[model samples]
Target: MKNDFEEKMADIMIGEAVTALLDEGVAIGWAVLTERLRLAIENETDENRVRAGLRAIEEVRREMHTRASERTGLPRVEDRSAHKLH
Candidate 1:
């Protein structure tokens, strides 16, 4: 059986996917929310909200890393070129 941490991480990964799905023109009836997410990425004027969104995104990414480690039994490659000869 998967460890609790691994299971939580997998759930977070799925949540992140759902968030991304909603981000791509899902029309959640709140443009501000989406704009905030965009502004978070683009570093908009609202630093506090931007920071919050960034934190949320970062948390999801961390969870994804954990889940990937569990599912793939590997870490993500920072440089795929290392796998190939240039």
Candidate 2:
């Protein structure tokens, strides 16, 4: 079904983004990572899928920061009143 295909594609995209994060570390900023992924899927003609991919990237980044903060005993940047996601 179309729903199943979309879910799988999102999962794959998230996995690739996670790999990129692990491989590149602090060097890959959120904007750069999103742009890199946008380029990777530039051939994807569906606007909806492209938007979904962007959402997935944001979600992955949020999850990463959340987990990191949990393990490090530091507040996530989002938790800081003065700082926000870059």
Candidate 3:
């Protein structure tokens, strides 16, 4: 019975971790989308498309920043070295 309970608890913890990871991934994806959208809007000749894309990108960027802030409490450290110029 004790082993069974432990296994169940472990499963629950693992599930929670997976969910958090997925949320973090989604946040990161939004950041990437924002950058790509910005590039596309800059190169776009159609004024309507440019305006719409800018609006969309701004929304996505806001969401990404919010999600990123939410995930900041997670147990992880930033790898500053990876972003440093050589």
Top lDDT model: 2
Which lDDT values do the candidates have, in the order given? 0.52, 0.72, 0.56
**Number of the top TM-score candidate:** 2
lDDT of 3 by residue, 1-86 (tens): 75555445434433443455567775435555556566665777876556566566655655666667568853212444566698
Candidate 3 residue 74 Cα shift, in angstroms, is 12
The clash count of every prediction, one per candidate, is: 0, 0, 0
Give the distance in Å from residue 46's predicted Cα in candidate 3 to where it truly belongs: 1.2
lDDT of 2 by residue, 1-86 (tens): 76666667777776786587778774666666766677656787887677668666666678778888999999887788656567
- Local accuracy of candidate 1 as per-residue lDDT tens digits, 1-86: 43454455444444554576577866442343444445445845654444545554555555556677678866555444566787
Q: TM-score for each prediction?
A: 0.39, 0.50, 0.45
C-alpha lDDT of residue 48 in model 1: 48
Error of 2 at 1 (Å): 21
Task: Tell me each candidate's RMSD, in Å, in order.
Answer: 10.3, 7.2, 18.2
